[model samples]
Target chain A: MEAKLKYYLQIADNALILSHRLSEYCSKGPFLEEDLANTNVALDLIGLAESMYIEVARQENEGRTGDDIVYRRKETDFLNVILVEMPNDDFAHIMVRQFFTDVFHQQFFSELRNSKDEFLMGIAHKSIKEVLYHLKRSSEWMFRLGKGTVEAQEKAQVAINKYWKYTHEFFLENDTDSEMLKAGIGVDLSLIKKNWLAKVEEIFTMSNLTIPTNDFTIEGGKQGYHSENLGYILTEMQFLPSKYPDAIW
Target chain B: MNITALSKEELLVEFEAKINAEQKIEPLDWMPDEYRNHLIRQISQHAHSEIIGMQPEGNWITRAPSLRSKKILLAKIQDEAGHGLYLYSAAETLGVTREQYIQWLHEGKAKYSSVFNSPALNWADMGAIGWLVDGAAITNQVSLQKTSYGPYARAMVRICKEESFHQRQGYEIMWKMMEGTKDQQEMAQDALNRWWWPSLMMFGPHDSDSPRTGNAMRWKIKRETNDYLREKFINKTIPQAELIGLKIPDNNLVLLEDGTYKSGDINWDDFWKNVNGNGPCNEQRLAHHIKAHTEGAWVRESAFVSGFQK
Candidate 1:
């Protein structure tokens, strides 16, 4: 049960953190239509987080609500990957971050639909459809910006170089992952990584972009270590709930 | 359809007759330059207001008290962006490009609602903005659905539907907070205190001082006077405030025997000051907008160069 809870938290925290990052673009998109698109994507991610958190709460059976699990957790308790917590420095960086995750989720959720856990299967089934649309949108932007103009191409390359190292953390297996895999209630990370790399390579080729050749990688988010940005995100996200701990918002 | 053959006097008589009969004015229809200019200014300002309005409410999206509240706030702000697009499209029919309108906004040549110049300091301000600010906008927009221009009226029809949802969500936030702890109730009241008069100012200056009201009313462009709509909003809103156990923030607020609610005079000096670009957040709002626009320049250039113009 603890392993399953950790697995669920790992996925939920990723969605929640990334949704928080994207929500920052709510009223600040490059244009009106793009703003709406970014919000739609953010809403989808947050919705997924809500569902996963609900499942985690039910599984824990400690009378904890989804909000309790999400809003009351300390920074060291979160299990999101370091990639999702990275700052959205520009449109290029935002789209690259999303593009990397969407590709991974496309493979991860598709395999997750076959999980032995019924609840996990149900979430994966619903999430797969949303992630496919997300994949299409992010990939289209990646192609446009990568192949468009000299400046856009340069910006896209810079973002890819900065974010590529974080992609390695997606495949880093831990005890919770191994336990879920043994129980047939989680995806095989190695397989998902292989498929993710293949799809990313294909898209990069089409976009006239190249993958980073550096072997260095950043890790630790799944084990609760995170960048400084995650602390700021938590401070803001948990401010109201922390201040009035017992009040219903 | 070539009204070029008709003299200006003859065209003016026909145009006046169409407007008198409450006929819809299409983009291709023959109209005076003044009418086109009036609609452009009004419609573009409306669009810019939608864009700028996103900022105040957006200040709370990251810190909303709950997951549900966060989602609601995000969707509402997205709707504002949609409203901005719709109004910009409506303005484009008047032969001005969206680029020109955006440029004008960045240059401070175009004006949006001054109500947005105020900061949203507390979570309750979200409720107040949605309730009072959006409430006032709906009163004006409901009248705009009957505006003389066809495209503008259609856009308002779509906008008012979404805005009604925004107003309800805002009110729901206020209601929830009022029913919560004492601190929550105080926050709700404080939000009202800050947002109240600025909301009244959203109706623009009094009719006696408004120069364009005469031409706008004549052309059926403005369906109601600023003072008239402001009065209607107060009468409708005062009851809701009382029901929620919140004060109206005006000492002079009173109910007359005629069923109208009267309030004290608005701070015209402040209103004019904000309108003239001296408001508290005027520079901040414009600066943020310009920064976003400038940063996104590369993305826009890429999209255009990639043949994704549409």
Candidate 2:
């Protein structure tokens, strides 16, 4: 596969995987408004993912299609980060995970707008507008919970600690990403990492929270390997398409 | 008057002045305690309505006939939820915490819209809700954007922006049915028949009988009387029904001499019965709500453990 395709897959896979996770809250959120807001966000993510996949297939020029990349790809062939795949577990966990991912996504896309790759730059420009909204939303919750009550504060702290290790992988790039970076087809994730840290640190300070320092990082997602959660997700997401095998409505 | 009695009258006068001046009452503003109490009750009840409103439409999600239908239904339900959150937050601004408001609901102390207490019954109920229930809500909310309360009005503005498509989506569904098989058309009419009267009741009791109407109006909380709003909704929807080639539920629905449609009498007994927790799905709705809340405990716990709660 072309390095640009691989990079686009990572972007598409992040949206696809995270949106699937968020969609679990569709009927199940604690309140109705959140149910709608989360699902809207999920839909936006899925729509963005589809757009990215279309670009990838077009760029690859190897007889690939969006459906081929989406439904036909195996779990190991997907390249979403581990943080995007984690379960919500609760409102706080969801917020924490959303906060971290959004911070990285926002900064990554901000820089990717200047990418030498035209299609990638266009995608980044659009996706960044959405990522900015997501970051603001998650940051608002962070402030609300942190400043609201002792219980909220304690819970938010716990959620951050548990998800902290996954933050590192967002910046962990290998040879492929590096090659794309040199070609100006990929963003230097390191810049995104620095921006993410600063952004998160500021939110933490305002929320009266502390940042945890831990070096452990899970790196499998960028390599097409995933946690067990992906199995269940694919089963449900792909069930209808696979069964119909050319169904249209 | 003595100190206590004088203060009460003074508070009422101040509240009236603010309302007359068209100023929004914020959380920390000074006014009659009764005004605060009344708004808390009304706004929280509205909040509850949005939450419970999810059930009827939620029933049809997995069973939505087409992917487009499914997506639209999901989005509508989500919008309902978002409206609920905004209402809850708005209510919270009135000194009622989210937990307290929820407790009131679980204990049957707070009332949701009586309309939602009934079952969705069939797929057409989804259309009916969008066409009627949401239409009624929009009428009420459009007026409420001018309400005296700052947070509630501001939240309603945001909600109304997103809710623009809900009623249209429902109407679209009905239109589709109108163009589909005979069975589908009948299903649409049947849903409309069942849902029509209940939707009018969503505006609450007749103005004459309503206890809060005078004060709510004085406070700009209710911009129009229930009867008047009901008449407006009927006038607007009746033509829509005509365009869609579906009959309105009531044969008595007719244009008045002065260019308004007057609706038939609603079944108030049924409305009150549902309001009092005797509706078909009242228990089911509450049970599901409590179940979902409890089931998500571990997730909340994990969030707490992860410091995300902070």
Candidate 3:
């Protein structure tokens, strides 16, 4: 695969997978308003992913469509980081996961808004507003979960510890990243990493939460590798289309 | 004299006069206790139906065959949740809090539309629900737009506007399927068959059999009878289905002298069974809601804690 295509898939897959996970909370939210809010975010992310997939399909110039890329791809073919594929075991974990990605998306999309590729730059430009709102919501939840009560604080810390390992994958530099950066079509993850870390630290400090330093990390999803959880998610998401591939939905 | 200072008979006279004049009864307006209680029951039940309605459709959100379908379904579910809240707010004007309304649902002290107790076993059921179920609901709600209660009538107007799109999307799904492979067409037909009777049952019961609606009708809380709305829905929906080349699943359905299609007899036994909570998914729906609420208790509690308030 070319550098631009791989880069597009990476960002698109991240939004798609994360949005899929979030949609699982549609009716199961902590409250009615929160449920509606989460689904709205999910809808935004899906829209983001769709735009990227449309670009991918256009570049490939194949007969396959954006929906085809989503429905026909195998679990291992997905390029999202494992952080997004992690289960929402509880409200704390859901918020922690969202907070981490929202922080990354905030800086990443802001810098990507300057990409040499006009299409990608437009996507980033339109998407930055959504990412900022997502960041605000997740950050507010982090404070509530981390500073609310002893039990709430404990749960939030546990989620932070569990998901902290996957954060490094966001900054993983590969050949595609290097090439895309050289062409000015991609933002520097290392630069985004610096800003992401600062934001995380600021939120964590205000929330009175501990930041873990043990650097065990998970990777490889960007290269079409993922956790077992991705398999289950894809199974359900792809079931109907896989069952009746010839039918138009 | 103050409104509340008036004698009970005077208040009833005033309330009845407002009904006669088609005046909206606001939250602070003096109403009879019977009217308030009835409105609470009806509106809260409507709210609960919207909330429980999320489950069957949410079932299809993950597997919604296409990106457009998935987005539509998710947005529709979100809208349903919003509708639920709107209704809850409207019912609260009658002195019932949302939490209390929810408790009634959880404890079986209240009831929602029993149509949801039927399982959505196929992808085509999504289309069926959007088409048939929403089609039936919109017919009733369009009439509800004229209800005497101010908040509920306004909520109905808002809901009816958004609801038509839901029915159209559902019909589009069915039409697309009917235009697809043999298997796809069969799937659509099967969904229609399963959902046909239940959709009819959504009107509660025939006007002749529903003795309890007298008070509701007299107050204009319900502007149309159950039978009239069901017939209106049938009359409107038949041509749409015929245009799509889909069957109505009613063998005895016939075009009458008035040009309205009259469907076959509904299974009242089954209707009563579902209403009494013996339907296929009754326990599951209530259990799922209770579980979500119970599990989310700590999260709700966190918002009230001193640290969170700080």
Candidate 4:
């Protein structure tokens, strides 16, 4: 695979997997309004993934449709960060995962809007607005939960501690990043990491939460190394298309 | 003279006059205890139905055959949640808290629409639900827009608009399926067969047997009878099903000269069974609802503690 194609898939898969995770909260949200809000965020992420997947299909030029890329790929072929594919164990966990990703996406998409590739730039420009809203909502929840009762505060802390290691995967760079950056088709991850940490620290302080000092980071979802969760997600997501191959839904 | 000083008989006379004159009964206006209780029951039940209705369609969101379908399903389910919120707010105006209503639901003391007790077993079930279930709901809600309660009527007006979109998207799914391979067509037909009678039952019992119908109609809370709305749904939906070439699952269904289709008898025993919590998915639906509620207790408590509630 070409570096450019691999780069697009990496970003696209992150949105796709995370969107799938968020969509699971559709009917199961704690309240009606929260359900609607979560689904809206999920829809926005899916829209982003659709656009990126369209570009991926175009670049692949293998007669593969966007649906083919999303539904037909094996778990190992997905390039999303493992953070996105984790189960939504609780509302706090969901919000914490979202906050981490939303902060990264806010910076990443804003910078990607400056990419040399016009399509990537267009997607990034359009998506950054939605990501900003997501960031605000997640940050508000973070503060709400952190400053809430002892139970809520503890839950939020637990979620942050559990998910903290996954944040490292967001900044891990590979040859695809180097190639895309050299070609002006991607933004630098180091800058995104710096901005991400500062934002996390600032929000954590306001929420009365502490940032983890742990240095151990789990990686490899970008290289198709994933947790056990992704396989179950794909099995459910791809069931219909796989069962009735060649039939239009 | 203080409004509260009015005698019960005098207050009843004024309330009846206002209702008879087709005036909307606002939240702060004087209403009889029975009227208030009736509106609370009806509106809260509607709200709970919308919430419970999410699960069957939600079952297919992940397995939606395409991105477009997945997004549409997600949006539709989200709309159901929005409808739940609207109806819950409307119910809250009757002096019942949302927590109270939800508690009743979790306790199985409150009733939602029984149609959701049936499972959506296939991807095509999405189409059937959107077309048949929502089509039936719109028929009932269109009449509900004229209900005497002001807030409930306004909520119906907004809900009806979104429901029409849901109905169309559902029909679009069926249409696309019918145009696909032979197996796809079969799937659509099978789904319609399973959903048709249940959708008909959504209008509640027949006029003669419905206990709430008389009082509801006298109060103008229900402008049409169950039989009337069921007829209207049948008349509107049969053609849409025909256009998609899916069978109605009613062997005895016929288009009467009065332009309404007369179908075979509904399985009222099954209907009552489902309503009384004996249906295929009654346990599953309520269990899922209670689980979500119980698991979210701490979250709700936190929201309250943080002054997130008004």
Candidate whose lDDT is highest: 1
User: By how many angstroms RMSD does model 2 differ from the true structure?
Assistant: 6.5
| Model 3 chain A weakest 10-residue run by lDDT | A141-150
Write down the C-alpha DockQ for each prediction: 0.71, 0.14, 0.74, 0.68
In the range A74-126, model 4's lDDT, one tens digit per residue, is 98888899999989999999999999999999999999999999988998989
* lDDT for each residue of candidate 2 in B127-234, tens digit (9 for 90 to 100): 889988989999888888888889989998988876668889889888877777666777789999888888888888898889889877877788899988988888
Q: In candidate 4, how many clashes are counted?
A: 0
DockQ-based CAPRI category assigned to the predicted complex of candidate 4: medium
DockQ of 2: 0.14
Please list all clashing residue pairs in model 1, or write none if there are none: none
Worst 10 residues of 1 chain A by lDDT: A25-34
Docking class of 3: medium
Residue A48 alpha-carbon offset, candidate 4, angstroms: 0.8
Error of 2 at A221 (Å): 7.4
DockQ for candidate 4, please give it.
0.68
Docking quality (DockQ) of candidate 1: 0.71
Cα lDDT tens digits, model 1, A1-249, are 499999999999999999999998877777777888899999999999999898888888999989998899999999999999999899999999999999999999999999999998999999999999999999989888887898988898999999999999999999999999999998999999999999999999888789999989998999999999999999999999999876788
Stretches of candidate 2 off by over 4 Å are A1-10, A26-44, A53-86, A91-116, A129-249, B1-36, B51-99, B118-128, B145-162, B169-197, B206-223, B245-269, B287-310
Model 4 misplaced stretches (Cα beyond 4 Å):
B1-4, B308-310
Query: Listing every candidate in turn, what is its Cα RMSD in Å to the true structure after a full C-alpha superposition?
Result: 1.7, 6.5, 1.3, 1.8
lDDT of 3: 0.91
Score chain A of each prediction against the true chain A by TM-score and list the results: 0.98, 0.95, 0.98, 0.98
Q: Model 4 compared with the native: what TM-score?
A: 0.97
